[model samples]
Target chain A: MTATQPKPRTSRPGLLGIYRSDLGKKYAMAISGVFLLLFVFAHMVGNLHAFEGPEQINHYGEALRELGEPLLPRTMLLWVGLRIPLAIALAVHVHAAYALTLTNLRARSGSYDGRNYLAAGYASRTMRWTGVITLLFLAWHLADFTWGIKTVNPDYVRGDVYGNLIASLERWPVFALYLMAMGALGLHVWHGAWSLFQSLGINNPRFNAYRRIFAIVFATIVTGGFVTVPIAVQLGIIG
Target chain B: MNLTLRVWRQAGADAPGRFETYPAEGIPPEASFLEMLDIVNERLERNGAEPIAFDHDCREGICGSCGVMIDGVPHGPQLGTATCQLHMRRFDEGDTVVVEPWRAAGFPVVRDLMVDRSAFDRIIEAGGYISVSTGSAPDANEIPVPKDAADAAMDAAACIGCGACVAACPNSAAQLFTAAKLVHLNLLPQGQAERDRRTVAMVDTMESFFGSCTNHGECETACPKGISIDTIALMNRDYLKARLSDRRLLGRS
Candidate 1:
């Protein structure tokens, strides 16, 4: 077989790779898992500045702006460039997850017998649904903040991003949505963090205790950081 | 203790199986679940009936031959014990324990509870071994594996080729079992020579037989040794790296 010739994608036995056959799906998950994990850490750091005063948080955002500084055509294009790939990654991860889930559900049509507790963790079991909700929240969050599309406050400005955030969170429904999205983010991180260690071949039975502990700690930090943003903004603390 | 049992019975591979109810009256509560089945078989034999053909060997739970769904849960309702290791004391008196074989298309039922797990052997044959020739054994400490790597490899090696993961997983994925083999062989220095080839062959074979993982935690939960789902992730990373990094395969004949 020459290098230029396209390699045939062999379909393994058992109906189009339901549950066990698809190799691409597994790596799609792993590679995307790495990217998503990086996004989580970056997002957490950006969110942590909220715990300081409003100026500190806005300064952090400004620092982010400095990375893609020379805004030639549009200032918001910098943010859009960063977000587009993240959105694409999110779309692939969630779409593959949903497709894999549907295939698995069909294959195991006769076998389910209430072995809910037999699964590895609560997070793994609910990964599909949680992924769907997280995607929806991501779209809404982008419109509300990134693109400055829809906000409760019509006076939302482009470069005045921090002020726009403060105004948006002051509304009861917007605050509630932020809280719910953060909770979903917490669930995603709780399992994904430890699983990343496993993917990178860091699993030791002895160190597994450490891995679980770190998972909880990381989950807590991300959850606390994101949740603090909305809560602080809603109150008179951040504005 | 007297208990009711609904067991799946099929005479041959082609025969369709169904649940048959049997009233089992046992005097000992400390007997293993398989021992309880043995007691029921003894009675069947005396009555000029063919014994219930369930798979078991080395009742110590190390052989991985004995596996069954009991009361809708694999290996009964125990947290981390296989059927051979599960005791009768866990069940209440007069309880109805439903028993069934490991049901998956890849594992066809050969007898009553004996499904052909040769698929696992086939997967192994596809490339589950180190290619070290039959030569003199190397020095024990020659291949100095790091403590962490050795520890992790041993943990992965803990898997006993049991179909419990396949049976328990909603997707019937052999990722845990296949991954265990991948991790154990890929982690050691001796196994490093065949590392790239090992991952591609084993994982490709597994993909040919089992379902893809959707991050369901059932396999880890059903595993008697508490093998984590992270093995699947490691296998994924290794396979991807191998696909890109295998230098020998780049310009070879």
Candidate 2:
């Protein structure tokens, strides 16, 4: 056979090019997902300090503002260094999720007439629905606790983290909504943790079992930990 | 065995397509899926109708040319079997199988049950090969590959460019096909020289036309060759490494 001339080398895609693709979006989602996971886990642990008493939990909330005090202005370091990055991660995660969903919708113009999802799990299938729920829940959570929005939390007070949590959870409807959101968070994190490793290219058959266990355990702990707070408050254990 | 086939038909790519039901009678249980289609087509031809235009070559299931959604499952319900290899015995008499083309924006239908998978070809053209100098065969012992690596590479190489992974995926992702190609080459000694370049180019090309892999595992199920999703993980690793390192090689200061 005659030797064919090699084609000219195509210019390498830049970082922007990488982000434009489906794989790049997945990487963005995974990396940002890790950041969000860290924040979620930390938030759950911080909230769990409420079990000790109002003083312990209140101090923990105050410590967040006092982070990096000598080197930086009050609350400046936490807001600038940590919160900003977390916000960026959340933005990227949501953006990528939306873009991927649109692309996926376009890719398959129509569903199968007689379809069966043999291999897909409940968590995998409900990712979009859970994601939307989590987003809405996040907004409500921030409004009620962080921003002290009176409409959502009539008794919300600034800097009084423990009191605010109890006042919000005192309402049965609020407690139920919080519990439902945590359930959605549990499902989201369960699938995200398991699949994030694959997105980051760490999958191996040998470690797959461990991945599954980690996802379930981590999701359960975070969700269960958060759920305990409202239940504790409602039961007057912490209130 | 007698069967009812709701086959999708389209006059052209721009034209609308719809499912047309037809009776497939007196088909032997031993006949392959394509053979059953052949009998149906013969009857349609005798009745002065336009015979179904489907894609098939190498009915032995090696070429990866034949594929259709049977009862909404790519390559039917048989695991790890191609459409051509699926026999009528898998379906019982009086079964109503809904046959449709691989429905994806990237894979447009050319006619009845045949899709234009040239997007896959474009991905291959992007970078699915090594830049080997044309010459006589090199000695087998020149560069010895580990037994496991060779086996793994061969396993990934088993992909026949079939679009079942795309069809089977809800997201219509081509990660399985692209990963198979990338792993088949990247695992080998010859392929190492351009591994980074190949990963970036091929993945970029794939993302242009396909959906993202959400770890749905449907691609592995739809794969006639039973290609593992592990290959996709390997490809992701390589692409990440390539994006970071390949920039330096491009003389970007």
Candidate 3:
């Protein structure tokens, strides 16, 4: 756009270049991953209202519905500003994961017949599987709670967040599914939290320990907070 | 040490490869891995059989020419040791040792345990160097590199161009190798002029045939020189600066 600008050193095709290159795809994945991580953490903290009894939990749900009442409108800010952005983030994360999987496969022209791993942790290796399971769990979760699908949760009430949570986890099979999903989410976060820093080029040997501790603690807290409500309901502590 | 070798036998790049077992009996424990292979090849030739094909030079660990997946671990189970430095004593009697080439799209099998690692040369050629006037070695006093930068650069410079990092990575990523090469030069004052161009060009060349890094730490474990993964973070920083800065990488400006 300027006369003094230097010549194009790369044929890097703009935004499309991000998707075409290996590093750019990771940047997309890591950036989107950050939003998803924040969403899950905030979701868990909000859900902790269930411990304060039905009144607090239901009020928390209504607060979300009326996020920008006077300034904007009921649910306007929540849907347009938060939920829609989260959905896009999730979509981008999934897209990047799918593309990278193919690249990794092709790069490995073929593996050694006796190939074995030395330092790749189980959580790092099982990211794709855990990621898929997390997606499936998200669908079930939305149906049972957000969409109020009768078949997914017969006792789901539109605004009764506490009642819906209790009714859903009361079923043994549903409880099992939630627990399994939490395990998968924990593993995904463990690898992803640290990986995001590397993908973003914000790393050094000096702060590696802090990065590790953050990944473990974040994974633990997020998984623990979300699962606490269901376990409390099952134990009759919330009733 | 008496070892049973399950060595991959391939005639050429396009030839059908298979495991060809051979007994390496009465081998001295002190003999290097390549030396043991030498003994095996000598016996095979005496019996009118084709010797195993492999790459080796400067039996010392510095050359980086010799390497293989010894029992599934690149450069064998001995950590921070090259295949040339790995000794037969690392094995036991009657052990079944598996030897295979670095199997990656970027590194095709030439024959037997030998792989064509020319992909690495191409990556380096893309940028891994600084432009110089090619007269003679400049006086060390002319350029005063800070102690920290010099040490870090030396650490990166220890890379031997071995493909073990690629062979060990589950994704076959050359990020570690490329990072080391980039860091070795990018950290110096001499590399400032073309730093951004070198980073972008080398990284693009690397991704052409290799996979992306996922921070598995496998490459560091399999690396003979024990190069740290922090170099990768540095390369990432350099690349982002080049592509995201206001300076447009536009054509012929």
Instruction: Using lDDT, give the best candidate's number.
Output: 3
The residue-by-residue lDDT of candidate 1 on A1-239, one tens digit each, is: 11122134353333223223355655455557778877887887887676676678777777666665565443355457666776677776776676666656543425633444555677766666667777788888878877787543576787675778887888889899889888887787788776656545555556778977887888888788778878877777777
For candidate 3, give the lDDT of residue A24: 84
lDDT of 2: 0.88
Give the distance in Å from residue B52's predicted Cα in candidate 1 to where it truly belongs. 5.0
lDDT of 3 by residue, B172-224 (tens): 89999999999999998888878888888899888876888988989999999
Better of 2 and 3 by DockQ: 2
lDDT of each: 0.74, 0.88, 0.89
Each candidate's fnat, listed in order, reads 0.29, 0.61, 0.58
lDDT of 3: 0.89
Per-residue CA lDDT of model 3 for A167-239, tens digit only, reads 9999989999999999999999999999999888888768878998999999999999988877887899876
| Candidate 2 chain B: worst-modelled 10 consecutive residues by lDDT | B133-142
Q: Model 2's DockQ?
A: 0.43
lDDT of 2 by residue, B117-164 (tens): 888887888788878853456664577899988999999999998799
Query: What is the fnat score of candidate 2?
Result: 0.61
TM-score (all chains, Cα) for each model: 0.77, 0.93, 0.95
Q: Give one digit per residue, the lDDT tens place, for model 1 in B1-253.
A: 9998888888998888777888789638999999999999998899998788999898887888899988767777886878999998999999988888887666777877777777688678867887776346666476678998898899999988878888887687788999989888888887888888788777776655566675656788888877877787678778767665655756885
C-alpha lDDT of residue B227 in model 3? 95
Better of 1 and 3 by TM-score: 3
